[model samples]
Target chain A: MHADSTTTRKAAALAAFAGLDREPGVAKPDPILVVDNVVRRFGGLTAVDVAHLEIQRGSITALIGPNGAGKTTFFNQLTGFDSADEGSWAFNGKQLKGVPAHRVARTGMVRTFQLTKALSKLTVMENMRLGAQNQRGENFFRALVPGSWRQQEDEITERAEELLERFKLNTKRDDFAGSLSGGQRKLLEMARALMVGPELVMLDEPMAGVNPALTQSLLAHVKDLREEGMTVLFVEHDMDMVRDISDWVVVMAQGAVIAEGPPDTIMSDQRVVDAYLGAHHDAPMSAEEFEEQLQEAEAELEAEIEEKA
Target chain B: MDWNAILITTVKASIGLETVVYALAAIGVNIQFGYAGLLNFGQAAFLGVAAYGMAVTVATFHLPFWLGIAIGLAATVVLAFLLGIPTLRLRADYLAIVTIAAAEIVRLVFRSVKFSSVFGGSDGRQNFSGDFFAMNPYSPGTYGIGPISFNERVTWILTVGWVLIAICCGLVYLLMKSPWGRVLKAIREDEDAVRSLGKNVFSYKMQALVLGGLVGCLGGFLFALGQASVQPDLFSTEFTFYAYTIVILGGAARVFSPVVGAAIFWVLLVFVGNTLSEAVSAGMLPSLFTVNNIGAVRFMLVGLGLMLLLIFRPQGIFGDKREIALDAR
Candidate 1:
């Protein structure tokens, strides 16, 4: 069909993101999210063109790619912020096309943004309240009756407070969210996502700008998400963090997945190396290099805390 | 100034006609912008819609006053939904724009020559408030504890208005403390994160919009019944702007913030206005301005106060800077 370089690139991306060599028999019994042929065009640029992708039920899958590789766009499309020009997906068995972002969230698939949109003016606890907002008591009639709204309000606050505590944000409950550091915000974002008790949680760059010392804890939290029986799909640039925590890895280059497999195999793949290291494929930080950085951060943090005491 | 004069001024300013109505409207704005963070700029439309609803039902259809109120509340919710459905997911500013436009549309609709019979056009409907006064328990005689007495009719309106304010504020306080309130705060902080938790962000936003609009509708009711009239000129964009000013002045997102804000807003404006006019008449200052400048000067002073508040305490009196720190856009 004499497709241009962009289409070829998209076609290539689609092939790679679709998990190139998957045989039909190997697929899971039921997929939580099944994204097929989801192509998104922004102006003249085709940002994402995935032929097929399946998020397994109750497992952590890290959607890893370089910047501008359409990871966030893909996440937005799935969650209803952005609509797909072509393609369809579903949460559990429900087809998700034309579903509004809010409705997508209602179906038990929630997400966090790359840029933290925490209500800066509200207390940290108030932010938690927003996460637990449901429709039952939000009705006009219910709002008119104090007795009707109290129990639900109490339960939501308690749960939100508990989640904040679990995330180590309990002490800052009264503090404004804007007062928190970048890392704390990331933590708050993650904690807030647990509000609606979603079956699927999508995190956009959960560890992108976090300090190394907290990276492990963040990674642990992502792993804990799976432990808690919620499927976690996260977009990450830190390969070591992805490799260390993710059960399955999906790698994208130029808006499509180029490789999908166990971390060890994906890391060793020739194409994956070329994508990260460029055609010359040399002089990139190794896994050992990453481990050393995290270790150093951990040591320094411990020393500081010890000194404070 | 005499103690009696100040007391009268304070009472007139606090429980004054415009004060009670705007207080109800400002509380609604708090629900929309302060609580839900919807950034609604067309709250006046809710007031306008409800007023027109009442005016049409009463003056046009000759229906009972309560039925008109129901239609008005319904119309506000419908207006909110119509505005929210198209623009809620768009940038928050889009909702602001659409609402402002819708409110203007509503005002024009009420004032349009084509619908003059039903809406009473520009001059609006009057003597329509007789039904509202029929429900008043107060006799048609003045009553008071002392110098703070009110005309029988004025007392009746204020009584109803204050009760509505208390109920709305109390309801807001309880509702805001609930699970739904938590979700709204979360949406304000991070809609994406809330959505990740399987929450319906859009639906919640719509609910907030409608709820806030429903509350705003009460302002229209109070205004219509307070003056015993409904005028197209009354529901101007400035009405909503003033409500926002009240919300910000008292505090955004706090239960008592709007009520306190409404009282302060009306008082400062009236007190300053009266003081300025008296000063100009007495020639206390050089004749740089005439009595006509009092209105402009009062507005300028109020605008200056809002500016100072935004600069020094953008969160208003009760708002936390952090809660307001979320990208307002």
Candidate 2:
């Protein structure tokens, strides 16, 4: 029964993109974030130069690329962490091009870092409390008068407790964030991001250093975010995660989008294969195959030397 | 050797005016550097500006004493803003550099002959604290136990200084427990992490700077009132360094640690200096340590003691061991 229900939900999640063409920068039925002519240059090298792209609302979109593909840079620009040389993008139909990172987050879109930035000195609970928005006691004058914000403070703590429980970090609530293991910190960061009550959540490599044992739980959490009706945009190199949780996939190479489609189709796309594996190679070279080829080349050189002698 | 006098002097110096001044300054440093992780090497500038503000208002302009107090606090806030606006948004090192330079600049400006009429140049200003003494409610008598006592004027100033320190400590305790202070602490750890969570990191830093500067200004007010004079040379870089030393020695991030740190620091200096001078005069030490050079040698011994403290217990007297481990991250 669970399997059948999950398939139905997955189908419903992908129904929005059913009629869209499998092409780079295809228009979505409902775009929550729209980008146009976003370009970033570093000296003589053009880092990110995406012409146009749209993120479908309430769908899990995976941004995948090889090393130095500018996937992280593009995420920075969209989330206001880094400024683009020239670009225009809108979140929820509001112009967010020049907005600062904190203001952008205030507008219901929050991001996590590529290198997880868990505030080490803060306790897990304090880190969670810092994530909450519109805190009354966060104001300097209001903080001095506890009577004014006592109720709000209690409510925020209650919410933080709920998130901590959900993320399975309740046991480590009072421990410093720095004390958490790599996997636990990832879960805490995701749970903390949810404390903002964001509509669109952006995660940069949520599973970068996480162990495989914890990868299953992390994947479930990502899926749960979509179930709760929040859009998720993530930059990742893990294709298994993208295929399992992502509803749609956008592939970038050389700082530009190369392909866009459902996960299965995008995996089979020839352009993606060319981008990952060079055009001349029909299939990816495995380590064993590479080793065999190296041995063969060395043997051939020895035979040539023997013939010459 | 007059051992009784030396012991009494040590006890007195522990809670003396110098202790109150450094304690207040260190409390301010605790807020900015300890809690917020701001590198404000120019904290002396905040105190300098406050002293000069009051001196210029009351002695030079003939304003009311209360107005001078208000102006002193206002000048501290303005100085915090001026330093914070350009550097708080940058990395932590920038504030350290700017603050150290700004403090020297403030001292130089006050020492300049061009503003001698207004700021009194090297002599600074005097007779500005007459109104402050006139308001004291203490009668003309010594007040204390045994040998450690104060006159009416000193008793009043000490009472005010201790009260101000209590209020500042209370304020720090309340703020650090709130979400506002949590944001500052988080910013101290990683500003980008706090920024990503929707906090205006720059504003919080600026507020921490201003709050700390105001606390530092209280120290300046007490110093000026206690001496009835403000000297430009007294508010030098070493004054700020002494405050930093006290903060680190007491324990960073704890509300009352600076107070404890200040008392210990003063007692050590006074005790060591007195002992050294007495030994030199009594012929208890070698001729290499004459009375004239004992002052300098006393400092060297104290420096060695501080170095030992840092090596053995870097977290200070009251700091959490867990915090020191987290700082390694």
Q: Pick the candidate with the highest TM-score.
A: 2
Prediction RMSDs, each to the true structure: 12.9, 6.0
- lDDT digits (tens) for residues A1-309 of candidate 1: 423543443333234335434321134445688888889999999999888788777667788777788888988899888889999997888999888776787778878878876667667887776666464666656765668867876887899888987889999999878888888989988887787678898888888788888887787777667766788888888778777776667877787777777655677777777777686547678899889989999999999999999
Considering every candidate listed, which one attains the maximal DockQ?
Answer: 2
lDDT of 2 by residue, A11-48 (tens): 77699889889888899989999998899999999999
Stretches of candidate 2 off by over 4 Å are: A1-5, A282-309
Per-residue lDDT of candidate 2, residues B1-329 (tens digit): 97998999999898889999999999999999999999999989999999899989999999999999999999999999999999998899999999999999999999999999999999999989999999999989999998899999999999999999999999999999888899999999899888888999999999999999999999999999999999999999999999999999999999999999999999999999999888888999998999789999998999999999998998999988888887676
Residues B46-121 of candidate 1: C-alpha lDDT, one tens digit per residue? 8888888887888788898889888988888889888998999777889888888888888898899998877878
TM per candidate comes to 0.82, 0.94
Docking class of 2: medium
